[model samples]
Target chain A: GAGVSQTPSNKVTEKGKYVELRCDPISGHTALYWYRQSLGQGPEFLIYFQGTGAADDSGLPNDRFFAVRPEGSVSTLKIQRTERGDSAVYLCASSDIAGAREQYFGPGTRLTVT
Target chain B: AQSVAQPEDQVNVAEGNPLTVKCTYSVSGNPYLFWYVQYPNRGLQFLLKYITGDNLVKGSYGFEAEFNKSQTSFHLKKPSALVSDSALYFCAVRDMLDTGNQFYFGTGTSLTVIP
Candidate 1:
Protein backbone atom coordinates (compact mmCIF):
# COMPACT_ATOMS: atom_id res chain seq x y z
CA GLY A 1 0.00 0.00 0.00
CA ALA A 2 1.14 3.49 -0.65
CA GLY A 3 2.48 5.31 2.41
CA VAL A 4 1.84 8.91 3.27
CA SER A 5 3.06 11.21 0.50
CA GLN A 6 3.92 14.91 0.49
CA THR A 7 4.04 17.15 -2.54
CA PRO A 8 6.67 19.67 -3.59
CA SER A 9 9.45 17.70 -1.86
CA ASN A 10 11.35 20.96 -1.72
CA LYS A 11 10.14 24.54 -1.72
CA VAL A 12 12.07 27.80 -1.61
CA THR A 13 10.35 31.10 -0.99
CA GLU A 14 11.28 34.58 0.14
CA LYS A 15 10.61 35.94 3.59
CA GLY A 16 7.14 37.49 4.06
CA LYS A 17 5.84 35.24 1.28
CA TYR A 18 3.20 32.56 1.69
CA VAL A 19 3.64 28.83 1.10
CA GLU A 20 1.44 25.79 1.28
CA LEU A 21 2.62 22.21 1.84
CA ARG A 22 0.42 19.28 0.92
CA CYS A 23 0.09 15.79 2.34
CA ASP A 24 -1.71 12.66 1.15
CA PRO A 25 -2.22 10.09 3.82
CA ILE A 26 -2.41 6.36 3.33
CA SER A 27 -5.71 4.78 2.40
CA GLY A 28 -8.07 4.23 5.32
CA HIS A 29 -6.05 6.44 7.66
CA THR A 30 -8.41 8.58 9.68
CA ALA A 31 -5.89 10.55 11.67
CA LEU A 32 -3.33 12.90 10.13
CA TYR A 33 -0.66 15.07 11.69
CA TRP A 34 1.82 17.76 10.68
CA TYR A 35 5.21 18.43 12.23
CA ARG A 36 8.23 20.63 11.69
CA GLN A 37 11.88 19.58 11.89
CA SER A 38 14.75 22.00 12.23
CA LEU A 39 18.36 21.06 11.64
CA GLY A 40 19.76 18.68 14.25
CA GLN A 41 16.38 18.43 15.94
CA GLY A 42 13.47 16.05 16.15
CA PRO A 43 10.08 16.72 14.60
CA GLU A 44 7.87 19.12 16.52
CA PHE A 45 4.14 18.61 16.30
CA LEU A 46 2.21 21.31 14.44
CA ILE A 47 -1.37 20.19 14.08
CA TYR A 48 -3.53 17.07 14.02
CA PHE A 49 -6.80 16.23 12.36
CA GLN A 50 -9.25 13.51 13.18
CA GLY A 51 -11.68 12.94 10.38
CA THR A 52 -12.62 16.12 8.54
CA GLY A 53 -11.91 18.50 11.42
CA ALA A 54 -8.82 19.44 13.33
CA ALA A 55 -8.85 17.78 16.69
CA ASP A 56 -5.98 19.79 18.04
CA ASP A 57 -4.23 22.90 16.80
CA SER A 58 -2.47 23.72 20.02
CA GLY A 59 0.91 22.72 18.64
CA LEU A 60 0.73 25.39 15.98
CA PRO A 61 3.45 27.95 16.71
CA ASN A 62 1.32 31.03 16.07
CA ASP A 63 -1.59 32.45 14.15
CA ARG A 64 0.57 32.52 11.05
CA PHE A 65 0.46 28.73 10.88
CA PHE A 66 -2.71 26.95 9.91
CA ALA A 67 -3.66 23.50 8.63
CA VAL A 68 -6.72 21.89 7.20
CA ARG A 69 -7.66 18.27 6.49
CA PRO A 70 -10.78 18.43 4.46
CA GLU A 71 -12.51 15.07 3.79
CA GLY A 72 -10.13 13.46 6.27
CA SER A 73 -7.59 12.34 3.71
CA VAL A 74 -5.48 15.16 2.31
CA SER A 75 -4.02 17.92 4.49
CA THR A 76 -2.36 21.22 3.78
CA LEU A 77 -0.12 23.31 6.00
CA LYS A 78 -0.23 26.99 5.22
CA ILE A 79 2.24 29.57 6.45
CA GLN A 80 1.48 33.27 6.24
CA ARG A 81 4.16 35.97 6.02
CA THR A 82 6.85 33.34 6.34
CA GLU A 83 10.00 34.25 8.18
CA ARG A 84 13.50 32.90 7.70
CA GLY A 85 12.98 31.02 10.93
CA ASP A 86 10.15 29.11 9.21
CA SER A 87 12.72 27.29 7.09
CA ALA A 88 12.66 23.61 7.97
CA VAL A 89 11.37 20.24 6.85
CA TYR A 90 7.62 19.80 7.15
CA LEU A 91 6.62 16.22 7.90
CA CYS A 92 3.22 14.58 7.55
CA ALA A 93 2.07 11.41 9.28
CA SER A 94 -1.07 9.33 9.36
CA SER A 95 -2.48 6.47 11.40
CA ASP A 96 -5.60 4.38 11.55
CA ILE A 97 -8.17 5.16 14.22
CA ALA A 98 -8.44 1.53 15.30
CA GLY A 99 -4.73 0.83 15.02
CA ALA A 100 -1.98 1.73 17.44
CA ARG A 101 -0.50 5.21 17.69
CA GLU A 102 2.50 4.39 15.51
CA GLN A 103 2.39 6.94 12.69
CA TYR A 104 3.56 6.43 9.12
CA PHE A 105 5.61 9.39 7.93
CA GLY A 106 6.03 10.88 4.47
CA PRO A 107 9.21 12.04 2.73
CA GLY A 108 8.41 15.56 3.95
CA THR A 109 8.54 18.93 2.20
CA ARG A 110 11.65 21.00 2.89
CA LEU A 111 10.59 24.64 3.07
CA THR A 112 13.38 27.21 2.79
CA VAL A 113 12.47 30.82 3.48
CA THR A 114 15.21 32.81 1.81
CA ALA B 1 3.50 19.13 29.49
CA GLN B 2 4.99 15.89 28.06
CA SER B 3 8.51 15.62 26.76
CA VAL B 4 11.33 13.18 25.94
CA ALA B 5 15.10 13.51 26.09
CA GLN B 6 17.98 11.81 24.31
CA PRO B 7 20.79 13.02 26.53
CA GLU B 8 23.49 11.74 24.19
CA ASP B 9 23.98 13.64 21.00
CA GLN B 10 26.12 10.89 19.50
CA VAL B 11 27.23 7.35 20.28
CA ASN B 12 29.78 5.09 18.61
CA VAL B 13 30.15 1.34 18.87
CA ALA B 14 32.16 -1.25 16.99
CA GLU B 15 30.34 -3.79 14.87
CA GLY B 16 29.52 -6.98 16.75
CA ASN B 17 29.64 -5.09 20.07
CA PRO B 18 26.62 -4.07 22.12
CA LEU B 19 24.92 -0.73 21.64
CA THR B 20 22.65 1.39 23.75
CA VAL B 21 20.95 4.74 23.12
CA LYS B 22 19.57 6.43 26.17
CA CYS B 23 16.05 7.97 26.37
CA THR B 24 14.02 9.43 29.20
CA TYR B 25 10.55 10.96 29.25
CA SER B 26 8.30 13.12 31.40
CA VAL B 27 4.52 12.93 31.26
CA SER B 28 1.63 13.53 33.58
CA GLY B 29 0.26 10.05 33.05
CA ASN B 30 1.54 6.63 32.01
CA PRO B 31 3.62 7.11 28.91
CA TYR B 32 3.54 5.35 25.59
CA LEU B 33 7.24 5.24 24.76
CA PHE B 34 8.47 4.72 21.23
CA TRP B 35 11.76 4.56 19.31
CA TYR B 36 12.28 5.60 15.72
CA VAL B 37 15.24 5.51 13.33
CA GLN B 38 15.89 7.84 10.45
CA TYR B 39 18.39 7.40 7.67
CA PRO B 40 19.96 10.38 5.98
CA ASN B 41 17.34 12.39 4.09
CA ARG B 42 14.59 9.90 4.93
CA GLY B 43 11.55 10.15 7.13
CA LEU B 44 11.57 8.64 10.57
CA GLN B 45 10.76 4.91 10.80
CA PHE B 46 9.05 3.32 13.74
CA LEU B 47 11.16 0.79 15.60
CA LEU B 48 9.23 -0.18 18.71
CA LYS B 49 6.77 0.95 21.32
CA TYR B 50 6.12 0.13 24.97
CA ILE B 51 2.37 0.37 25.51
CA THR B 52 1.86 -2.05 28.36
CA GLY B 53 2.46 -5.63 29.44
CA ASP B 54 6.12 -6.67 29.58
CA ASN B 55 8.74 -4.03 30.25
CA LEU B 56 11.05 -5.61 27.68
CA VAL B 57 9.81 -4.95 24.18
CA LYS B 58 11.34 -6.32 20.98
CA GLY B 59 11.29 -4.38 17.74
CA SER B 60 12.53 -4.49 14.17
CA TYR B 61 16.15 -4.91 13.02
CA GLY B 62 17.23 -6.94 16.04
CA PHE B 63 16.47 -4.10 18.40
CA GLU B 64 14.89 -3.98 21.83
CA ALA B 65 14.09 -1.47 24.57
CA GLU B 66 13.71 -1.68 28.31
CA PHE B 67 10.97 0.30 30.02
CA ASN B 68 11.92 1.50 33.48
CA LYS B 69 9.03 3.14 35.26
CA SER B 70 10.94 4.24 38.31
CA GLN B 71 13.78 5.72 36.31
CA THR B 72 11.37 7.26 33.78
CA SER B 73 13.54 5.82 31.04
CA PHE B 74 13.11 3.64 27.98
CA HIS B 75 16.53 3.01 26.51
CA LEU B 76 17.06 1.28 23.15
CA LYS B 77 19.53 -1.62 23.09
CA LYS B 78 20.89 -4.13 20.67
CA PRO B 79 23.01 -7.12 21.61
CA SER B 80 25.31 -6.78 18.63
CA ALA B 81 25.85 -3.74 16.51
CA LEU B 82 25.90 -3.72 12.72
CA VAL B 83 27.41 -1.10 10.49
CA SER B 84 24.08 -0.74 8.78
CA ASP B 85 22.57 0.28 12.10
CA SER B 86 24.32 3.59 11.96
CA ALA B 87 21.60 6.24 11.80
CA LEU B 88 19.79 8.94 13.74
CA TYR B 89 17.47 7.71 16.49
CA PHE B 90 14.61 9.58 18.13
CA CYS B 91 12.73 8.89 21.34
CA ALA B 92 9.08 9.85 21.63
CA VAL B 93 6.45 9.89 24.33
CA ARG B 94 2.66 10.15 24.24
CA ASP B 95 0.18 10.35 27.05
CA MET B 96 -2.48 7.68 26.80
CA LEU B 97 -4.92 9.83 28.70
CA ASP B 98 -4.46 12.98 26.63
CA THR B 99 -7.59 13.24 24.56
CA GLY B 100 -5.93 15.74 22.26
CA ASN B 101 -3.49 13.06 21.06
CA GLN B 102 -0.36 15.15 21.32
CA PHE B 103 3.03 13.41 20.96
CA TYR B 104 6.50 14.61 21.85
CA PHE B 105 9.89 13.69 20.37
CA GLY B 106 13.41 14.13 21.63
CA THR B 107 16.19 16.02 19.88
CA GLY B 108 17.62 12.79 18.46
CA THR B 109 20.89 10.87 18.85
CA SER B 110 23.26 9.94 16.07
CA LEU B 111 24.62 6.42 16.25
CA THR B 112 27.73 5.45 14.31
CA VAL B 113 28.36 1.71 14.18
CA ILE B 114 32.05 1.44 13.35
CA PRO B 115 33.08 -1.51 11.30
Candidate 2:
Protein backbone atom coordinates (compact mmCIF):
# COMPACT_ATOMS: atom_id res chain seq x y z
CA GLY A 1 0.00 0.00 0.00
CA ALA A 2 1.50 3.27 -1.08
CA GLY A 3 1.20 6.35 1.10
CA VAL A 4 0.06 9.72 -0.02
CA SER A 5 2.51 11.31 -2.44
CA GLN A 6 3.18 14.76 -3.85
CA THR A 7 4.72 15.66 -7.18
CA PRO A 8 7.75 17.91 -7.67
CA SER A 9 9.13 17.33 -4.18
CA ASN A 10 10.58 20.82 -4.50
CA LYS A 11 9.47 23.89 -6.40
CA VAL A 12 11.13 27.26 -6.89
CA THR A 13 9.29 30.22 -8.29
CA GLU A 14 9.74 33.97 -8.38
CA LYS A 15 7.55 36.16 -6.25
CA GLY A 16 4.33 37.20 -8.01
CA LYS A 17 4.41 34.02 -10.07
CA TYR A 18 1.72 31.42 -9.84
CA VAL A 19 2.37 27.85 -8.75
CA GLU A 20 0.31 24.71 -8.55
CA LEU A 21 1.14 21.84 -6.21
CA ARG A 22 -0.33 18.41 -6.68
CA CYS A 23 -1.21 15.68 -4.23
CA ASP A 24 -2.18 12.05 -4.83
CA PRO A 25 -4.11 10.58 -2.00
CA ILE A 26 -4.15 6.96 -1.01
CA SER A 27 -6.36 4.62 -2.96
CA GLY A 28 -9.98 4.60 -1.85
CA HIS A 29 -9.51 7.46 0.57
CA THR A 30 -12.59 9.61 0.57
CA ALA A 31 -11.17 12.49 2.58
CA LEU A 32 -8.18 14.65 1.70
CA TYR A 33 -6.59 17.61 3.40
CA TRP A 34 -3.94 20.21 2.62
CA TYR A 35 -1.69 21.97 5.06
CA ARG A 36 1.09 24.53 5.00
CA GLN A 37 4.14 24.32 7.25
CA SER A 38 6.42 27.29 7.71
CA LEU A 39 9.93 26.85 9.04
CA GLY A 40 10.07 26.20 12.76
CA GLN A 41 6.32 25.99 12.98
CA GLY A 42 3.58 23.39 12.93
CA PRO A 43 1.53 22.55 9.88
CA GLU A 44 -1.58 24.68 9.41
CA PHE A 45 -4.75 23.53 7.75
CA LEU A 46 -5.45 25.00 4.32
CA ILE A 47 -8.39 23.02 2.96
CA TYR A 48 -10.28 19.77 3.24
CA PHE A 49 -12.20 17.72 0.73
CA GLN A 50 -14.73 14.99 1.08
CA GLY A 51 -15.35 13.17 -2.14
CA THR A 52 -15.37 15.44 -5.20
CA GLY A 53 -16.28 18.63 -3.37
CA ALA A 54 -14.47 20.64 -0.74
CA ALA A 55 -16.17 20.10 2.56
CA ASP A 56 -14.22 22.76 4.39
CA ASP A 57 -12.05 25.37 2.77
CA SER A 58 -12.28 28.07 5.37
CA GLY A 59 -8.63 27.50 6.23
CA LEU A 60 -7.59 28.95 2.91
CA PRO A 61 -5.73 32.18 3.57
CA ASN A 62 -7.26 34.21 0.78
CA ASP A 63 -8.52 34.18 -2.77
CA ARG A 64 -5.02 33.51 -4.03
CA PHE A 65 -5.06 30.13 -2.31
CA PHE A 66 -7.38 27.63 -3.90
CA ALA A 67 -7.60 23.83 -4.07
CA VAL A 68 -9.71 21.23 -5.79
CA ARG A 69 -10.21 17.48 -5.78
CA PRO A 70 -12.18 17.09 -8.95
CA GLU A 71 -11.93 13.34 -9.43
CA GLY A 72 -12.05 12.73 -5.70
CA SER A 73 -8.62 11.16 -5.68
CA VAL A 74 -6.02 13.73 -6.67
CA SER A 75 -5.94 17.30 -5.44
CA THR A 76 -4.24 20.43 -6.72
CA LEU A 77 -3.37 23.50 -4.69
CA LYS A 78 -3.09 26.70 -6.62
CA ILE A 79 -1.39 29.79 -5.29
CA GLN A 80 -1.50 32.99 -7.30
CA ARG A 81 0.85 35.92 -6.83
CA THR A 82 3.23 33.89 -4.75
CA GLU A 83 4.84 35.79 -1.91
CA ARG A 84 7.97 35.22 0.08
CA GLY A 85 5.74 34.48 3.00
CA ASP A 86 4.37 31.55 1.01
CA SER A 87 7.78 29.91 0.94
CA ALA A 88 7.03 26.81 2.97
CA VAL A 89 6.29 23.12 2.81
CA TYR A 90 2.90 22.09 1.54
CA LEU A 91 1.63 18.83 3.01
CA CYS A 92 -1.17 16.59 1.82
CA ALA A 93 -2.94 13.95 3.82
CA SER A 94 -5.68 11.40 3.26
CA SER A 95 -7.79 9.18 5.45
CA ASP A 96 -10.51 6.60 5.10
CA ILE A 97 -14.09 7.67 5.30
CA ALA A 98 -14.58 5.87 8.58
CA GLY A 99 -11.48 7.34 10.24
CA ALA A 100 -10.91 10.87 9.09
CA ARG A 101 -8.93 11.55 12.24
CA GLU A 102 -6.25 9.00 11.44
CA GLN A 103 -4.71 10.72 8.46
CA TYR A 104 -1.64 9.57 6.56
CA PHE A 105 0.62 12.35 5.30
CA GLY A 106 2.71 12.72 2.19
CA PRO A 107 6.39 13.64 2.20
CA GLY A 108 5.38 17.23 1.36
CA THR A 109 6.31 19.70 -1.36
CA ARG A 110 8.75 22.44 -0.44
CA LEU A 111 7.85 25.60 -2.33
CA THR A 112 10.33 28.47 -2.32
CA VAL A 113 9.43 31.91 -3.57
CA THR A 114 12.40 33.99 -4.54
CA ALA B 1 -13.13 28.13 18.09
CA GLN B 2 -10.69 25.41 19.19
CA SER B 3 -6.97 25.65 19.80
CA VAL B 4 -4.00 23.62 21.04
CA ALA B 5 -0.99 24.77 23.05
CA GLN B 6 2.48 23.34 23.48
CA PRO B 7 3.81 25.58 26.22
CA GLU B 8 7.39 24.31 26.02
CA ASP B 9 9.50 25.60 23.20
CA GLN B 10 11.92 22.72 23.72
CA VAL B 11 12.62 19.78 26.01
CA ASN B 12 16.01 18.23 26.69
CA VAL B 13 16.66 14.78 28.06
CA ALA B 14 19.63 12.42 28.26
CA GLU B 15 19.62 9.02 26.65
CA GLY B 16 17.99 6.37 28.86
CA ASN B 17 16.33 9.07 30.96
CA PRO B 18 12.63 9.83 31.06
CA LEU B 19 11.09 12.59 28.96
CA THR B 20 7.82 14.44 28.86
CA VAL B 21 6.33 16.94 26.42
CA LYS B 22 3.33 18.82 27.72
CA CYS B 23 0.26 19.68 25.62
CA THR B 24 -3.01 21.38 26.49
CA TYR B 25 -6.09 22.09 24.42
CA SER B 26 -9.28 24.11 24.58
CA VAL B 27 -12.47 23.25 22.75
CA SER B 28 -16.20 23.56 23.08
CA GLY B 29 -16.91 19.86 22.77
CA ASN B 30 -15.46 16.46 23.46
CA PRO B 31 -12.06 16.88 21.91
CA TYR B 32 -10.28 14.51 19.56
CA LEU B 33 -6.64 14.77 20.60
CA PHE B 34 -3.68 13.75 18.46
CA TRP B 35 0.13 13.74 18.55
CA TYR B 36 2.37 13.87 15.52
CA VAL B 37 6.13 13.78 15.02
CA GLN B 38 8.02 15.40 12.19
CA TYR B 39 11.60 14.76 11.25
CA PRO B 40 13.65 17.33 9.43
CA ASN B 41 12.91 17.47 5.70
CA ARG B 42 9.84 15.29 6.05
CA GLY B 43 6.14 15.46 6.64
CA LEU B 44 4.17 14.75 9.80
CA GLN B 45 3.70 11.20 11.10
CA PHE B 46 0.86 10.34 13.34
CA LEU B 47 1.94 8.98 16.71
CA LEU B 48 -1.24 8.47 18.70
CA LYS B 49 -4.74 9.78 19.23
CA TYR B 50 -7.24 9.96 22.06
CA ILE B 51 -10.82 9.85 20.85
CA THR B 52 -12.29 8.17 23.87
CA GLY B 53 -11.99 5.28 26.29
CA ASP B 54 -8.54 4.97 27.85
CA ASN B 55 -6.95 7.86 29.64
CA LEU B 56 -3.42 6.66 28.84
CA VAL B 57 -2.77 5.84 25.19
CA LYS B 58 0.38 4.19 23.86
CA GLY B 59 1.88 4.94 20.48
CA SER B 60 4.66 4.00 18.14
CA TYR B 61 8.41 4.14 19.02
CA GLY B 62 7.76 3.56 22.69
CA PHE B 63 5.82 6.77 23.19
CA GLU B 64 2.68 7.30 25.25
CA ALA B 65 0.34 10.14 26.14
CA GLU B 66 -1.96 10.72 29.05
CA PHE B 67 -5.26 12.40 28.32
CA ASN B 68 -6.75 14.39 31.14
CA LYS B 69 -10.21 15.73 30.77
CA SER B 70 -10.44 17.74 33.99
CA GLN B 71 -7.07 19.41 33.45
CA THR B 72 -7.44 19.76 29.69
CA SER B 73 -4.03 18.24 29.01
CA PHE B 74 -2.51 15.40 26.99
CA HIS B 75 1.14 15.06 27.92
CA LEU B 76 3.40 12.80 25.87
CA LYS B 77 5.80 10.66 27.88
CA LYS B 78 8.45 8.03 27.41
CA PRO B 79 10.08 5.90 30.04
CA SER B 80 13.51 6.13 28.43
CA ALA B 81 14.63 8.63 25.82
CA LEU B 82 16.77 7.89 22.80
CA VAL B 83 18.77 10.10 20.49
CA SER B 84 16.55 9.01 17.64
CA ASP B 85 13.57 10.44 19.50
CA SER B 86 14.80 13.94 18.91
CA ALA B 87 12.39 15.77 16.63
CA LEU B 88 9.49 18.21 16.56
CA TYR B 89 6.25 17.23 18.25
CA PHE B 90 2.86 18.80 17.61
CA CYS B 91 -0.39 18.47 19.49
CA ALA B 92 -3.62 18.78 17.59
CA VAL B 93 -7.23 19.04 18.61
CA ARG B 94 -10.44 18.59 16.68
CA ASP B 95 -13.85 19.50 17.96
CA MET B 96 -15.67 16.34 17.05
CA LEU B 97 -18.96 18.06 17.54
CA ASP B 98 -18.34 20.42 14.69
CA THR B 99 -19.72 19.51 11.30
CA GLY B 100 -16.49 20.55 9.67
CA ASN B 101 -13.49 18.33 10.23
CA GLN B 102 -11.11 21.09 11.20
CA PHE B 103 -8.01 20.42 13.31
CA TYR B 104 -6.12 22.94 15.36
CA PHE B 105 -2.38 22.42 15.81
CA GLY B 106 0.06 23.84 18.30
CA THR B 107 3.27 25.67 17.47
CA GLY B 108 5.19 22.46 18.25
CA THR B 109 7.83 21.56 20.86
CA SER B 110 11.29 20.49 19.79
CA LEU B 111 12.78 17.57 21.67
CA THR B 112 16.53 17.19 22.00
CA VAL B 113 17.89 13.87 23.31
CA ILE B 114 21.52 14.13 24.33
CA PRO B 115 23.55 10.98 23.97
Best candidate per DockQ, number?
1
Per-residue lDDT for B27 in model 1? 94
Candidate 2 CAPRI classification by DockQ: medium
lDDT of 1 by residue, A1-114 (tens): 889999999999999999999999999999999999999999999988999899989999999999988777899999999999999999999989722479989999999999
DockQ of each: 0.68, 0.67
Model 2: residue A105 alpha-carbon error in angstroms: 0.9
TM-score, one value per model = 0.98, 0.97
Candidate 2 on A10-88: residue-level lDDT in tens? 9999999999999999999999999998877778999989999999999999999999889999999999999999999
Worst 10 residues of 2 chain A by lDDT: A95-104
Candidate 1 chain A, run of 10 with poorest lDDT: A95-104
Q: What's the CA RMSD for each of the models? A: 1.0, 1.1
